[model samples]
Target chain A: MLAKRIIPCLDVDKGRVVKGKKFQDIQDIADPVELALRYNHEGADELVFYDITASHEERKTFLDIVEKVAATINIPFTVGGGIRSVEDIYQALQSGADKVSINSAAITNPTLIETAASKFGSQCIVLSIDAKEINTGKWNVFQNGGRIDTGLDAIEWALEGERLGAGELVINSIDVDGVKKGYNLQLTKTIANAVYIPIVASGGAGIMEDFYQVLHSDIADAALAASVFHYNTISIPALKNYLVEKSVPVRSVPSCQLY
Target chain B: MIAIVDYGAGNIKSLQIALTTLSIESTLTRDETVIRDSNAIILPGVGAFQDAMHQLRSDNLDKILQEQAAAGKPILGICLGMQLFYETSNEGGLSTGLGLIKGKIERINANVKVPHMGWNTLQIRRNKHITTNIPDQTYVYFVHSYYATDIDNDDLIATSQHGENIPALVQHNNIIGMQFHPEKSGDVGMQLIKNFWEMVS
Candidate 1:
């Protein structure tokens, strides 16, 4: 059985993590590379580092951060935010990211996904969606960090992502941004049910039960949260242990779970 | 000194950093003499099998690894390197492997996730000396689509569940292979590497 993964996503801008409050006003958090190391030590299954605007700004800082993150941490890290081309993906992979995620670029140039998948293998690419609910009970797609609405249905766009060579899909709920109320389980489940690829549920994780809620749900393959993990409100090892004891099917280092 | 065969595959530095953490001196090299003289050999790799195999073949390190494994001095392969220890690979129109293990590498069934990428807990089915009776279920990190499948049950030391029965650890006497990245697996990973280092000591 594949263990359900709990990921911590750090949205980095200019090397500092910024959590978009309501997917708008961004606030400084911490140095991304240091945070990455902390999460790696804390037993995070995997990490997502979105260099929020690497594509637009052409910030070379991501590479430096990635190289250091790769050197300092041992866990698998995925680099995203402004990855528009195969060459960009290759550069990130060379910088030590286990995977590269694409957003706006893939929407603009769907062939970039095919080219990247063919060159680096589909497993290296992750299709991320910043989703917001719209009228008529349908969710709309947002790019450039939810600032631009593409008027695309979330589910259809997700299927296109998988079709265009995305190995995984990250359905990040813009509505649940920093709420800590719980995850947008229904939205996550919707995407997970739609795609054959592994789906990582992101946004609105407030408690340990939220983690379980996502993992036990039929639609989610993984759950990702930020503030809770960064603040140590609940430790990943503890959460994993609790889930393991509950027989919810989670992966945890042996000693931590047993004790 | 231990020799880490780095043929521009994966992050070879992780292993070097791991060795440093273990206080075990090592050098990253493709030099035959450096590899031949080292007390132990480690083959670390990632990326596509065909491209990685091409680099190894071009460097002529495949023959060296084959000879070294045959000599029965501890030789460990991680991830793609572990797949290379098999008889042949289904990757890219079939390529010959180092034949260190009597098995072939095949693609994982597409029904399950294509790349079984994530953290998976290890079930130590066989109580072997290398594992040192570490608890039955230990979590380790993994990131690969293909695994040594339909393998002989005897060769399997540990396993991870992911729809397909993934071999967490495999050993044929002194030649050992781990499907996960022990270097990046944190404490559990470091302990496994520490155990491997102990084998040479």
Candidate 2:
């Protein structure tokens, strides 16, 4: 049986991890590589490094961080945020990222998804959608960090992304992001049912039960969280044990000494 | 030294990085001489079967790899590289492979997801050198839409379930293949790499 994945997302700016707080054991929590290694050791199925750096010059530093993380960890990781073109995707993958996630650029230029998927297999092209519930049971895709509404139906956009050759979809619910309540199960389940590719549920993961509810219910193939993991609100091993107790199959946290 | 056969199929930077982390020297080269001189060869690929086979044949790597296998030089094929070891693949049309293993590649006709992309436990079928020190039901990462079917039972070393009995690992004498990307499979993957290195050494 394929095990459910637990992912830790890190926001990187100018090569340093952002929002990384409350890690006394880690000498430098700001170091993306160090944090990534910490996650890998704790049995994170994959890692996501969102390059939130805005300056073009600082983007080079983000790529450097990608290289360092790639060299340090063996688990698959995705580099997302600010990926605008096929050239950007190529640069990220060339710098050792297994996959690159595209958000706003994908909405503005949907063909970018097709071109990138054709150039660098669909398996490496991840379509990340930022969605918010605008009306009863209706969600709209948002851009620019949920500031602008694109008016694209969340489910429709997910279907289009799959049709456009996106191998996976990361559906992030803006309403539930950082809410600590739970994942927008209705929204994620709707999109997951609409698409054939794997759907990664993002934004709302407050407790280990939130993960169990989303994953065990089969609403999402993987659950990605940032603040909870970054702040030590939820430790990965303990979470996996909880999931296992709930009969949710998860990869056992392997001893890192083998490597 | 290991020569990673490069035919422009997929990004092999992670594979090189993994080898470096294992303190093993490797080079990504299409040059026949470099491949011939290396202690072992790691065939890493990601893409459709026909396109990859096309690139290999165009660069004369098909014949070179055949010669290496004939000479008993250990060869490890990862993902699509492993698929190329079969006799035929139906992806992108019915195309021939290296024919080192007796099987044909076909789309996974299972109820689950098409691309079985995640960590799955291995069911070691037979004891082999590659399975050394590896625990039974060990988890490894896999990402693919097709799988090898009708393979000889003797060559099957391990299997993983994903709506069907997916061949996770196979070996026939000096030729070995893994349907998953060991480089991205975390510690168990690195252990497999180390074991392969030990076999070659």
Candidate 3:
């Protein structure tokens, strides 16, 4: 059986990790490679290095970080944020990234998805969307870091993304982002059902049960969290143990002999 | 030294880095002499079958690989490279493979998903050189749409369930194939790689 994935997303700015708080043991919290290896050691199924760098000049530095992380870490990871073109996708994958996630670029040109998926196989092209609930049951796609509403229906965009050759979709809820309440299960499930590809639920993961709730319920194939993992609030090994206890299949940590 | 066959298929950087971390020396080369002289070969790829076979044939790596396999030299294929070892692939029409393994590559007909991506536990069939030190139900990363079917039962070493018994690992004497990326599969995958290195050593 396929194991549910637990992913830890790191926000990088000017080649340094941002908001990497509560790690007294780690030598440098801003170092993305060190932080990534820490997550890998704790048995994270995958890692996402979201390049939140504001300047184009510093983007090269972020790619350097991606290379260092790829050379150091053994687990699979995705490089997301600021991926605007086919060249960017090529650079990220050439730097040893297993997958590249595109957001605002896919919305502006949607053809970028088709081109990237064709140039590089669809397995490496991930369509990441930032969605916000506008009405009782209607969700709209947001771009530019959740500030600009594209007026595109979230479900329709997901279907379109899959049709456009995106191998996977990351549905990040802007409303619940940083709220730490829980994942936008309703939105994630809707997208998962609408598309045949895998769906990764992002934003608002507060507790371990939140992961179990989203993954065990079969709403999301993977649950991605940043702060909860960065702050050591929920260690991955312990979380996997909890998930196993709850009958949710997760990859066991090598050090943890519970299996 | 190991020669990682480079036929312009896909990224093999991570595989090189993984070997470096293991203190194993490897060179990504398409040179016939280099590959023939190397102790072992690692065929790494991530793409469609027909295109990959086309590249291998164009580069004349198909002949070298078959010759090396006949010479009884160890060669390990990963993902699409594994699929290329079979006789034929139904990926993009009926394309011929290297015929190292008696099997055919077909699209996964499981109800779960198409690509069969992400981590999946391996159900070890029997103890082998590669399965040493690896526990049963160990998880490995996989990212492919087609799988090897109609393989010899004696060559099968392990399997993973993705709504069906997907052939995760196989070995026919010196030639080994893994449908998953061992370099990206964390500890368990590293163990499998180490075992391969041990076999080569």
Whole-model Cα lDDT per candidate? 0.83, 0.90, 0.89
Model 1 chain A: lowest-lDDT 10 consecutive positions: A250-259
Task: Compare candidates 1 and 3 on TM-score and give the better one.
Answer: 3
Which pairs clash (backbone N, Cα, C closer than 3 Å) in model 3? Answer: none
Off by over 4 Å in 3: A20-29, A256-259
TM-score of each candidate structure, all chains considered together = 0.90, 0.97, 0.96
Residue-level lDDT of model 1, residues B49-150, one tens digit each, is: 888888999999999998998887799899998999998899878988888888889888756776787777788878776787357777787878888976
Candidate 3 lDDT over B61-118, as tens digits, reads 9999999999989899999989999999999799899999999999998788767889
**Distance (Å) between predicted and true CA of A155, model 2?**
0.5
The interface RMSD values of the models, given in order, are: 3.7, 1.1, 3.2
DockQ of each: 0.44, 0.77, 0.57
State which candidate, 1 or 3, has the greater lDDT: 3
Local accuracy of candidate 2 as per-residue lDDT tens digits, B1-201:
999999996779889988988999999999999999999999998888888988999999999999999999999999999999999999978999999889999999877876788899999999888988788999999988899999999999999999889999999999999999999988888889998988897
A38-65 per-residue lDDT for model 2 (tens digits)? 9999999999999775569988888888
Docking class of 3: medium
For residues A48-157, could you state the per-residue lDDT of candidate 3 as single tens digits?
Answer: 99877536898889899999999999899999988988988999999989999999999889999999887788899999999999998799999776778999999999
Q: After best superposition, candidate 2 residue B10: deviation in angstroms?
A: 1.6
- lDDT at position A110, candidate 1: 86
